[model samples]
Target chain A: MKRKFLRRVVSGLLVLSVVAAAFTGCGSASASENSSKDSDSASYRTLDEIKESGTINIGVFSDKSPFGYVDENGDYAGYDVYLAEQIGKDLGVKINYVSTEAANRIEYLQTGKVDIILANFTVTEERAQEVDFANPYMNVALGVVSPENAVVTSLDDLKDDDEVIVISGTTAETYLTKNYPNIKLQKYDAYAEAKTAFENGNGVAWANDNTEVIAFANENPGYKVGIASLGEQDTIAPAVTKGNETLLKWLNEELETLGSQQFFHKDYEETLLDTYGADYEETLVVEGTK
Target chain B: MDFNVINEYIPLYKNALLLTLKIGWQGILVSLFIGLIGSAILYFRIKILKTFIGIYIEIFRNTPLLVQLFFIYFALPKIGIVLSAEVCGTLGLGLLGGAYMIETIRSGLESIPVIQRESAASLGLNEMQSLWHVILPQAISVSVPGLLANVIFLLKETSVFSTISLMDLMFTAKDLIGMYAKTIEALFLLVVFYLIMLLPISILGTILERRMRYGQFGD
Candidate 1:
């Protein structure tokens, strides 16, 4: 009798789990169907629509510091946030900041989840093919950092067994994998974990955006950005959906107008001065005058 | 419904599934050891050890597993003790799983009739001998189902290790999504992988429970 009762309970659990999995499976099936339909429809907001609605959804990173991050009070505050706020003001719309990660930025734009991406989106040919990019706002390149005692100044300095820390999906990972396939990589999904892994001595060097490593070395003592630049120079720009021509045109004009007023320099002074100091002010900030 | 992308990534998924199983099994073994020791301490009601165990269980049980993992993998490095991501993830899962196991096993011990202990005492069995020879066997028989269920729960919980960069199954799926931007395909594959791992374990648990019940009740 006891055995019978136990068997019944087990079977019941099995049925319930199967039912749950089926429900989730069906849900995802429909979501994918919808995403494919959305891609065909090109259903994204225009400048007039956004202005009429009085709101623009801008995607920014909530975890990446200096570029974008949540402040101590749990509000979004960063260089990208400052720039996004300006775009909202110039467009005469209230800002609705949508938190996005590095990997999801393109998807967010494609799905109409956000009208613009300002999350330190580095311009690459592959990404540009999928989305429309406005004029560049800042310049960035990959850098490597390590402990001050055992600095890694270049890829050549790394030993065969040494592992380099990289955040998955970032340009650093792609650059190293394609260019320097000899070096081993320990990939982390998030910036915080990658930093921690580096601190734990799990890897010999941490490679990421030059601005990020500079900020990290400044924040954490005993670390230094030994290799300040390691890849092709790239520009960070605002990206719109594939066919968002009106919004893209507006952004380009806005950037050109902002350049006359030195808007980017003011933005840096307000959001990034403390972390990067004056040394990088001229090199990193782009006026977009052209 | 572009399953072709998923099919292309099957080899990567398979490798990730193996890593997930490896980490899950290691966590299970470590948790079982911790659970047995913890439950035994509680069953005997040791003086100071009980209080320490009580606090330990409460802290681990109440806090989120991700926070514990992050603390171990990230925060501990500041104090000079640094462990690999795999070790930190496994240790985190073991500690958390052990806390729940202790309570589940304790409840199993409570369900056993008081007369069994009294009879053992009268039959020349000392406290330790009675616990070992009589009480533990019965308690374990009763607790097999709960323990197995916990094992299944811990298996799923191992996905959280991906946050600490352990390259488990979830991390592989995330990597695929990051690469291809195919959210649904990657998520669907992840669910399928988890089901493949979990279903057999649940079925085995049921089998074990039925056998134990039949052995105990003589039906």
Candidate 2:
């Protein structure tokens, strides 16, 4: 009996030590990896390296329509996806589309999970410090959509209890939190959830990119874009890993060249024209920073 | 790595932690109540209610909490059953957890020897008395470990409450990360807060489990 007790205690200590060691090992390994990623672009592939690899991973939203969404045919089809295809063609590499969310766009680039982020990513000074933004390709601003029965026309109209639905990590969330602190915000991690919540009357209005809310209103009747432009106009651009100058320069030059050919115009015509019609083409398309 | 950001977010995390604990405790209580009732119904071999509970267990156990939450918060309103996010969160967690708790407690109840029940009945104890005095203590002793595990799981599952927009710990972390891109700081705070919330429960559970074990074996 004494021997059995000692053996049990000894084995228990061994198991506990093993678990502790495993946890510490994981913590240190991840810490080192994150630190290295922050200081340098060693993990990210260079433009030449990407070309040689013959495949480029481009992050795009798989839910936001007219921008980056999977179509009924189950293929990635949208404005950003169209640009990505053109990029793949110019770079002479096959495109590997990684579906990303609004929040993880920077993380995807920093972690070398994708070569570029074209997920309707709005350029902000804070985000630019973390990820290198290429030249602008489109124009965007915050917009709010609400049910026709109770349209939320202005920011001041939202009372304390009236929650405004916004997707996590989008410009809308930031804008509302900063400018209208009194308005309660209901945030969802995904666009689909936000839309569903809005439709279910969980929130009085849904705030998102003007392009997204506009498209949403066009696609789904009984809702209207009550606030077409809520905050400062921002440009949507491709983002690469910070300090990945080779890819960044290549993207800028590509955008500048693509501008001369009106590439974004064609992309808009193909992907966004049905939703926005012809009038929005000039306002929405940036065409290589010009 | 960034102590400043962590310090700045402490108040936010503190609020988030409270909401998380509130929901976690409420959900656990609900699960216990449901688990006890369902197990009793099964132990007595009640016919129709037993079948109904069996189906409930299978449905909640088979489906993910995220889906159930979406159904409760988003889908149900269409059928004229609207619930607030907090209510939906608690209900979803309780329903999902009750399923697992029932299975855990049922196994414990089944582990009690038939002779124990017969012996209680022969000793002038009624059915309720047999269950209350004789069967439950031994069955609960066996169940302590599994129930504790389920408790921990249900607490962790409260992380999903963020999906329904309940401003739980996970939502605060993700919101901070989204707004500021402070990945390391936000996630570090998230880990600390969750540990703060869960570790005490885990320690207390171990103590209770050890005490119960000592009582059962006298070792």
Best by DockQ: 1
Error of 1 at B17 (Å): 1.8
Write model 1 residue lDDT over B43-112, tens digit each, in one string: 8899899999899999999999889998998888889888877788779988988898888888888888
For every candidate, what share of the true interface contacts is present?
Answer: 0.28, 0.38
Q: After superposing candidate 2, which stretches have Cα over 4 Å from the reference?
A: A1-41
Give the alpha carbon lDDT tens digit for every residue of A65-133 in model 2: 878999999999999999999999999999999999887887888779999999999999889888889
Question: Cα miss at A29, model 2 (Å)?
Answer: 10
- Model 1 misplaced regions, further than 4 Å: A1-43, A71-75, A218-221, A277-279, B1-4
The TM-score of the first chain in every model comes to: 0.84, 0.87
> Per-residue error at A180 for model 2, in Å?
1.6
* Model 2 per-residue lDDT tens digits across residues B8-121: 999999999998888888888999999999999999999999999999999999999999998999889999999988889889999998998888899998998899999999
Highest-scoring model, lDDT: 2
Cα-based TM-score, every candidate? 0.87, 0.92
lDDT of 2 at B153: 96
Cα distance off (Å), candidate 1, residue B81: 1.4
